[model samples]
Target: MPPKLPPHTADALFFCPSCSTWRRSFTNTNTTNLLRRAHQRRRPASTLAASSHPSPASPTVNGARNVPERFRELYAALQGVRDVAANHVNMSRLQLALRGLEGEKGIVRVAVLGLDNTATTARLVRLLLADPLSEKAEWEDYLQTYRMESSRGLLIRYGEQTNLAVGNSLVPTISIPSRALKTGNLEILVSSLGARSISADQTIASDALLVPTIAIQSTSTGAHSFVRYPVHKSMVCGKGVNGLLAYTGLVGRVNPNTADSIRAAFELNVGEGATPEGNDGISFVDIERAETALDMFRESVQNATEYEKGWTGSGVQPLVDWISSPAKDVAIDPAIKRLVDSTLDGAEKSIVSEEKRKVLALEANTVPEEVRMALHETVSAWAERAHTELRDSLDQGFASKPWRTLAWWKLFWHVDDVGMITSRILRRKWLPEAEKEVVWMGGKIHQAGLLNQETNSTNPIQNSTEFEISEEKSSTFSRNLWPTQIPDTRKQLTTSSVPSLHRFAQNLVMFSLSTTSLSSALSALVYVSTSTTSVYEAGTIATIGLFYSLRRQQKQWDAARGFWEREVREEGRQALKETENVLRSVIHEGGRGIETAPETEARQQIDRARQALSNVK
Candidate 1:
């Protein structure tokens, strides 16, 4: 029986199922475990210490030794930009620029972009400073990052609206319409109908919580700074009308295609193989750990046998047969034999039919057909090599050498481990998830151009029985964030006004409900039925009595006059509201500060940071 394989190596192999799977690797070779561990004659500890540190001549920053050539170049480019002062002015300048460039395709104006942008930005800065690797580096890292994504924007609503109420201000609003998304103003109407001399009907709805992501293009083409925030709803209502208003918004899921487009742009600006952008504050030790892991992985792949790797489907069985043939002469331990058999069995199981095998062959087109067909031979050769090496080492007849004899199992374990580690390292190396959150230069703006298109214009006219007036076609929006619906303009609003009589003699109605007038009129008609003179006499007396009765009720008329005054006051109130439409706003009057910090202070910090970085090691 072959003695147990090295426990460390054995455990590593089974621990990583990905190593055997190699789901995203370029090759599917199973020869990684083919090598016998290099025999180490004793090496002095002093030599290991000498290799631990880098020479002075080597380029590095903040103690990151043996820096990649690419990073050196990147570091140079980063240092070259004289942007401290300009960058400091950038925050204020950008806010103005964004507001001024309204109506541009894909342009967005965030009075305040999102709820979480500033908080997240501050946290990110702290993280960058905490990274020990950049301990001695200049403040450039912090300042640049702070500007890059710091969203100190105030608050705003998503979509569009006609009115925003801020304190005593009533902002006039314009309609913003899309299919499933529609913005409505809080409609309030004053009335004086019957007992209600000054009544108000208000219909207010809760603001739909929305998350806003803003990607601002920088001076460089395609380069962008992106920020996101949750929207806070602020509107006046019943008890809350006089209180503070706040809205809730959620971060939207990025569309799949949009994510891909964004990733391409980020890679364009950030360079390939750099650590993901979000992890800018990690220590050099962590970076070194990653680099070491990568080196180990590359070496494992490099050590595999070339022949074992190229098994096209046609050659797989032959390789399998050859590998197991070692069972004939080597007298493998029953346990080891079963281990080999089961792993092989799994491979066969993965390709149950010929069709699947051919598909795999086509995918690995670089491997030659001859090598593919010789898979069986390759596996058998591996077994034979392990046996021969072990037998020869044993013949040396010094102390026993079990390593060469156990090389085959070690090879299996290594192969499995490399796959799992490779997947992890590769994913970290080519991170694509962060792309969705950032916008890059030259990124697609088709989805962001919604503001450039017009949506259905809904005019809320009073006294209308329908909900919509007319359907007007608008531009299409991305389905990921907005749903499309057929435009229907038949909608309308209904008004509740009291019936009135026209004042013109020809148009006015002579009808009156006064009891004395009605009684007099009926008596006159009966008197006229008997004689014209009697009817005339009775009509004159009835007219005089009617006038007297009206005169006696002057106190009642005075009371009714109060109701008319109320109706007039309601009209004036409505007119004033219309006049204040331009000044209405959603937030308190004091919430509109564009830049929270003084310009001088920001610029001073920028310069100070630049100077500090200049002095960094």
Candidate 2:
């Protein structure tokens, strides 16, 4: 159970720095500290590269360490939560930790796609069997198994005569009487070309593709393991499938200097054709292409395991070696390049007209309406479909998937592709001058230098030695601790003395005001108070007389007070000048200085004075 405070005292308050909104917080102490640290760092939860604008001084990312003890404890605490809540907690921490890792420099963005292996498939089966969330308890009865080799169509048909649609084409209707037996299967039709040779886009005359009947169903042992393979089909450029050439092409594009040497070596091998003398006899492009493909394959495998198995185990080199089975000299394998080219082609088709429209609209916003309207016209038929239909189809296809599972990855990809393009255009056309303005403002603030006076001065503000004065008040408070021993008379005398002193000070000020001559005011008080009687005399006669005489000589006291006040005021002005000078030196030289405790001292002094005055008699 959570802690319970009284209703009146349990009120919660919260705020967000981004929206600058105030609200109630159910967050606890740990949550509060996390927010405070984030504020100090001045970065979003999932940070990107530091903004081009000036960033707040943030702590440098710390090197990775062993798992934290706090996380271990948190993991243990999660056991108490309900199943759904436990999952939520785990997911929350997973995302937070992933964000932290991503924010680090040199960390590449990676998508881990896991293909089901035999061992992993078995584990998945066991988990499914044990799943408390499942409605069916009889596992064997609920499970259905399917063989991959079976010709059973994964399609099912519902009510007949419905209009079937695919990509702007409406097929002619066919009548299916309800009396003609259950779930009709189409007879196998032979074609001159094999199924594998058929293009994916070719239209087949039937509604068979509309319903998928066969699917890999959950079994007691688990679903069958799917083969791990690249989605891209390798396209060999030359006679053989040489990955070296592909790698070289990639390397050449990225690093021409290194590619030159590789190319020279390849030519040298070609010249010494017979047994290739001292050469490996592999083309430079072939060698590099093989290496690149191997590298990509290796990365993909590692990512697959990590994503599917949720494994954080170390020693990845073995997995890499196993995945990247590079063969010797072969033909030009254009697998990677082909994949990239196809993707780029698709993007270009969809993005060209849209990009044009964006640029035009942006320009229109800046130009006169008459000029903007002059440019308006119908886009080509291809351009309209290219810009619209493809986009709509792609969006619909993406929406049909289990998108929630891959939402974060998709969001990250979106940021990389679209956000980066947007930023580049904005910086090129709009932000250069704006950035200069910000820099100018920063320079002026640096130059106008104001110093924090409290950060300097030789004497400590609290005056640790001022304990004697504060101690007196403590003594007075303690004197009344044992009220029975002390007379109440002392308290009465002490209480009256404060008002009397104030009255005396007021009277002296009035007397000084009445007499225009300072000498008359001082002489009258000095003579009367000192010459009066032995009531003013004591063993500490000189000190006692000095105190009383100074008290009575209002005119001299006033003159000295005014003189010292003016002198201190001038000293303060000088101190400020000195402070500003020091600040300028620190700013230029990057010298460090300690903060002065003036405010702390002032507060302490005020407390002490109030206490002392309360006890004054």
Measured by lDDT, the strongest candidate is 2
Per-residue lDDT of model 1, residues 1-617, tens digit only = 11333444333322111010111111334433222111011111111222244442332332333333323332222222213223312222222221111111111211211122232322222221222222222232332233223221221122233222211101111111111111111111100001111123321111111123333232224343333321111111111111111110011222221111111001011222332322211111122222233334344655223312221211222211211222233322222222222222222232243335555543343233343234324333433443443334323321223222212223323323322332232223211222121122002222222122332123232343322222221111222221111011001000111111011111111222254677687767768676656766777767776665544433333333244334423432332232122111110111111222233433344344334333323
Write down the TM-score for model 1: 0.17
State the local distance difference test value for candidate 2.
Answer: 0.26
Q: Could you tell me the lDDT of residue 330 within candidate 2?
A: 26
lDDT of 2 by residue, 237-322 (tens): 11122223432333333212112112111211121112121222222222222223233434565445332322111112222222
Give me the runs in candidate 1 sitting further than 4 Å from their true place. Answer: 1-29, 35-541, 548-562, 574-617
What is the Cα-based lDDT of residue 446 in candidate 1? 22
| lDDT for 182 (candidate 1) | 17
Misplaced by over 4 Å in model 2 are: 1-247, 251-273, 277-443, 446-558, 585-617
